[model samples]
Every structure is written in structure tokens, then in C-alpha cells.
Target: MKKNILNIQGVSEISKAKQSEINGGAGWGFGGIDLSKCGCDCAGRVTGPLYCQNYFGCLQVYTCNDSQES
Candidate 1:
């Protein structure tokens, strides 16, 4: 059987406007993790901070032809 994880292999940023909402709020958006902490460069390129748990490997910045995780 083929399993579809949908979008499990990626990260997402909370909407800025929603960050100001009265909910849990975008902690990461506010200042939880910076681009560098997340291992992304100026253009969101991965700087190899990724720890590959998979026997294969996680996608590189250029592997997907882009900086964004997915």
C-alpha cells in the first residue's frame, strides 16, 4: 500500500496577521526561531543544519530546486 503523508515533509510559517490574534499566537513568528536557527539563509536556503533521520535523507535546498522546505 502506498502511504500519502500529504505535507509532512515540510515546514510552514504562520500568517503574520494571525500572529496578532488572541490565540496561542505565532510564537515562532514573533521571535521563537530565526532564519538561521531554522537553518535557512537570507533567501530561505538551508545551510545544512538539517539532521537526517531518514536512512535516505532530507531534501536539500537545491534538491527541490528551491530554498523553501517543500
Candidate 2:
């Protein structure tokens, strides 16, 4: 059996350029999430709010659930 894995470099730069074009030339910025659309049951799960940060025209999703107090 033969395995072929393609490694692409500098792909991030290309994505950044594309994202900038989509944002109308604006730099990366925080794009807030819609909590109403959140499916997590945050009642007793101690789940924190969804945090998003735009880095190089990419939207990164993160959660601070671990920092929440029980």
C-alpha cells in the first residue's frame, strides 16, 4: 500500500489575504458569537462563555470553562 501526504506551506498567508478581502480591507477583529445559537447547556456544566479572537483574518474559537468556579 502506498500513502501520499501532501504538505503545504505558507497556506496561512493565503487564508489571511482571502479573509482581508472578505472583510473589505479591514484588519482582523473580534467577531462576536451568537449565544442564542449556542447548543451547550451552560446551566450546570460550568461552561464559560464562548470567546472569539480574530488573528490574521481568522476567527479562533475558545472557551474558558476551566476557569469557571464550581
> Which candidate wins on lDDT?
1
State candidate 2's TM-score: 0.17
True lDDT of residue 33, candidate 1: 29
Backbone clash count for every predicted candidate, in the order shown: 0, 0
lDDT string for model 2 (1-70, tens) is 1122224443333567677776333233555453443342333232333441222122234344657578
Model 2, residue 20: C-alpha shift (Å): 25
lDDT of 1 by residue, 1-70 (tens): 1234434576445678977774552333543323334444444354543331211232354333445675
